[model samples]
Target chain A: MAKKSEPQKASPKSLDVSELMRDNDQPNFLNQMQEDFKKMMIDKQVLQKCIETFLDEIIDQLTLGIIFDLHRKFKTKAYCLEVKENEEEADAEQSEELPLSPVKSSPQKCVCPNCAQQVAALRFARHLAKCMGLSNNSRSSRNASRRAATNKEKGASSSSSYSANSDDDNDEDWNPRMNRKKDKSFSPKKKGTPKRSSEPDLAEAINTDTGETDEAKNLRHTRSNSSSPDSLSGSGNITPKKRDKFKKMGKGKERSSASTSLKFD
Target chain B: MSGKPENANGRVSMHLDVNNGLERVTELIETRLIESGWKDRVKLACREAITENNQNVPSVDHLIEVITPKARALVPDAVKRELLHEIEMIFSNIEKGGYTTTLDG
Candidate 1:
């Protein structure tokens, strides 16, 4: 055999060479190589196990991280969507109500006659009064007096004196017409002989009468004349003939004055 | 018996060097894991390392691929890159030696 021939050839060499040949035997070499291979495989397995554990840990972390990120993103998206929906709903409600607003507001809008500007109806009365230079208090008082006067005129004649008294009590600052009316009503009571009053008193009455226009005086005279003679006699006792005489005299005076002015011209 | 004492001694020293390097790598990894709030993961990895079958262990490249996204999620881009570089450097350093012995030394 080749192996036996090799050992016999080595046996002729030094002892060290035989020992080296024995040590280099195939079985022993193969065993050593096998042992080395096993150790290498074991080491590789150990290293692989360590890496696998580390990688598994990393994978777990990555999965958890991804899940957490998705959760946060979903939560934010949901919140944003909810907020957007609420805003949209509110906008829709406002849009639905918008059509009715103009109709409801139309009556509430008023145009100021003085300024020609649109104002709220609730404020228009105050604005108008202010535009007319009337304070709130004065306007209210004026309204009250006007109401009182209308009430008095609708009542019986016996209530005239009470009306005057009420007017005097309410209106300490009476107008010129109110003063004249009070004077005329009170004058009849003071002067028992109404027709025989002094010339100056008559002139004063005429002057006061000038406050009425000529047409108004004529209308008043015609109304008095048309009244029943019994009512006239009962109120004043002045003869109709005397009233006619006074009228003729007044016409003659006016005619004389006009003729004199014509001759002078 | 035929091997030189000096060669055996060199081999032993190289083995010790490799062990030390591995220990350093493990310590660095543990420190980073703890700092990044992966303490539970570290415990789980240790358990898995002990319990898993040898054949089923994952490769270094696969492990890196799995870890990249996780690290990216935990740290800033620059920090992630730096950590990955550091891990790669450790592996490269280890790889310079043969799989079984310190060929580089």
Candidate 2:
């Protein structure tokens, strides 16, 4: 029993020595482990921050690259033309590139179905208006202003200018010649222009206001040598005031030439 | 030029096929891109390409050529990381013999 107690005491002493040794070592080890852990956590956070920043930089660079690439790809010479004032350079370049195709600058030509005359496609509508003798004063004035504006800008094209002059000459010639023929007789000319001669006469009938009904209007139109109701009906909308003006102008037949020329010009 | 890694890649892809993992990854990437507004950004870029030309609308092929490289570069890193992680998971699953059981099931 005494031996067990003595050994128990000795064991306690050994345990105390071991405990003291462990106490000395533990704090240092634990502090080192804590420091290491803290360092690892900080490192992880820093690494994450670095990666995020890198990603952001990469995205920005890519966006910039995309913008530059798109700008380079889509910024074309034609796009600049809208903002540019001068088109002569482009025209000169085009002319140089297609020196063999000088006729490209000229307006296209088509046969006027009514007059059977070759007319510039650009001026074909106006030519048709005069050839059919369905001239509306307001519409013609608007068209003349539009044509003059186009002519000012397109003055560079010689063929278009020449076509414009010829078109004016033909319009004036047709007006005077048709008036002379109608005054002499109601005979239709070889060309289709005089077939429309009764149009002016129908305007005169409407201006005279001899009819209030369609049948009466038809009777008056037929009496004026207009056999076609279709042509009469088409021109029937010419206001009395305009027709009266025409009649007032027609009182002086020789002076009507100058007036008609001035009206068209 | 590769030896073992190429075999590993092939095996990983084969495993992905077994698990229908490739399609899921693709769907995930597409969803991520859409959620991140990357798709809208790309669409805006395409519109800009079309409208910048004054004379005529640019050809589809030309637009694609101009935009494709930048679009590829613009994919978010998070999506790329998730995709790479998914691939790693596929590889690990293959290594763990999960491929056989999944194929069997």
Scanning candidate 2 chain A in windows of ten residues, the lowest lDDT window is A12-21
Residue clash pairs of candidate 2: none
| Model 2 C-alpha lDDT per residue in residues B1-105, reported as the tens digit of each score | 101111222323333444456456445556676788886687577767778876677765677577777676667777867655554544455445533331222
Backbone clashes under 3 angstroms, per model = 0, 0
Off by over 4 Å in 2: A1-265, B1-14, B101-105
DockQ of each: 0.03, 0.02
lDDT of 2 by residue, A108-132 (tens): 8989885478888878887777655
Q: Please give the lDDT score at residue A233 for candidate 1.
A: 23
* TM-score, predicted candidate 2 vs. hidden true structure: 0.25
- Clashing residue pairs in candidate 1, if any? none
Model 2 DockQ class: incorrect
